[model samples]
Target: MSNLLKVIALLSLTVAAPGQSQADWQSHESILGAILEQVESNLRHTGEKYQIDVAPLDRRLQLPQCDRPLTVARLPGTRDLGNISVSVRCEGTQPWSLYGRAFVRLSKQVVALRTALRQGSLIAPGDVELVEKDATSLHGGFFNPEDVIGKPVRKSLAAGTVLLPTHLTTVKLVKRGQQVAIRAQNTVFEVSMAGIALTDGEAGQRIRVRNVSSQRIIEGQVISDGTISVSP
Candidate 1:
């Protein structure tokens, strides 16, 4: 074939190539949809404009609600959850959802439950289990302060208060010798050390403690002053 002809053919092929597009989220979208419905239910059922952000599907979820400006550049389905934005903020009904349904709120932010627990909110009600490592932020963009609010805003959380947001995957007690433990359910954790309960150890609180184990005062949460069990 003539070189000119070959060049023309290549150019034509390049132009004719099919372009790729975002995929549908499908059921994943449904879950998020449900969450949004919940928010609408609480938000007095009015559509509101909110922002939404999404993380890479593979990224581990850290926040409670999806980020703002939802994107689906990675997954399939125009309506699927695989490709959407996290950190979402939208305004519609108090709680809104597609077929999936979700709830949202304008005043209350859907932060990680772990963050709420840290803030000293009771983990009951409004708390939901994380489904997978790769999921949309939240189905809805708003929430009712009353329904989604954590336990009373604690000026400080006692050591024994259980930690939520299990993804707090990386927690290091700062004190060199402080003891630490994971408190859950309603049981008082066992004291793991004898070091001076650093930082006024109290009930349902995690404080920087010095670990008496190695005589190194390590930062630790005071599950319950001197009487609580410390996770070994």
Candidate 2:
């Protein structure tokens, strides 16, 4: 066989063959073979650590179990590199392995609260704040207090809201350049409130529609027109 196999065989013979009977030697060799196979497999493979919820072995586990992605605190080394440790966690599920794939417990961070304050950009529990050093550099500047202070921040921004610092900084409250739609087709029209009117439109939502053809203003559902209608 190969040199490694020969070496192991000789070593096993020296350690156990003399002390045990012939049958015992055969059994030990079989175990050695299995261990060698595992070593060889590990040599050729690579792995990473992921925390996931594992189902208990006692229960019937299902495939494609949706689990939260774990926050990776550390990473493993390459197949032939540094001191790597494949990390895995167990979730509420137990046992973890069916045949080979097992669910591991994992932890995730979520942004609970977010706002721009003069002190710096405020974030909730899991939000990660990235800081850059040079503004002119390709990475640009870090999240600064001036950038977020006095800026409208959301307690819970929608999925559409960009979380990146660059994108959030460029956002502004709709003011003069805001585009408004008019609604006139529906009878249940309403108008903006008196104090809340951003423009000339009255607040409290009164139905108002302006006919382009006759240049006449008609009162209707303020919101039903699908566009902002004016009082006629």
Candidate 3:
């Protein structure tokens, strides 16, 4: 009877203890780190320089080890670059999901004035410099230096101030009452006419013009400094 009892004890030990049936599962840290790495890689693919800050998951929280590699993805409609949430999931038999938040600080090279600029001062390459700035912080910031060059400032701006789209006018390509060559084009054919602009317009902007020969008012897009186009 004692031998039988000893044999039963040995059998219990050999059968494996409860909760030790499978390999140790992944820790919360490892899973969270994997998710963060995927998020960083996705952000980098956008081609914008950014400093990423991912909020850490609760250190004490327990997570089951995934037999397969864990999958990480951004939540739908969470495409914005600022504070955002991502989904981390394990597709194994013990499936689980969690949301992680990340703060992405995007940076860009934006145009900034090198010298104090007064209202009506024309912007030149020499007067502006491309400076690295927090992209999210600058509302309506100007990116292309050429877009602002030759544009007159609408308000006085201090030296080193970041340029905004609202601070400059679109360089006027056609002036009111100026004679402009009007070109009408389509897939089939092209035609040209002489017209007088009745309203000022920048390149690609629609403006009112009068046909010089017909004396009929028409709307056309300013194609260049001295040219406009109308659809027939």
For all candidates in order, the CA lDDT equals 0.35, 0.31, 0.78
Ranking by TM-score: 3, 1, 2
Q: Quick one: ranking by lDDT, best first?
A: 3, 1, 2
Where is model 1 more than 4 Å wrong at Cα?
1-79, 82-150, 154-194, 199-222, 225-232
Which residue runs does candidate 3 get wrong by more than 4 Å? 1-25, 46-48, 177-195, 219-232
User: TM-score: which is higher, 2 or 3?
Assistant: 3
Please name the candidate that would achieve the greatest TM-score relative to the true structure.
Answer: 3
| Candidate 2 local lDDT, 82-132, one digit each (tens) | 222222221322212111112222122212224333323444333334332
Score residue 181 of candidate 3 by CA lDDT: 92
What is the alpha-carbon lDDT for the whole of candidate 1? 0.35
How well does model 3 score by local distance difference test?
0.78
Cα RMSD for candidate 3?
A: 11.0
TM-score per model over all chains: 0.20, 0.18, 0.75
Q: What is the C-alpha RMSD of each candidate to the true structure, in Å?
A: 18.6, 17.8, 11.0
Better of 2 and 3 by lDDT: 3
What's the distance in Å from true for residue 148, model 3?
1.3
Model 3: how far residue 146 lies from native, Å: 1.2
lDDT-better candidate, 1 vs 3: 3
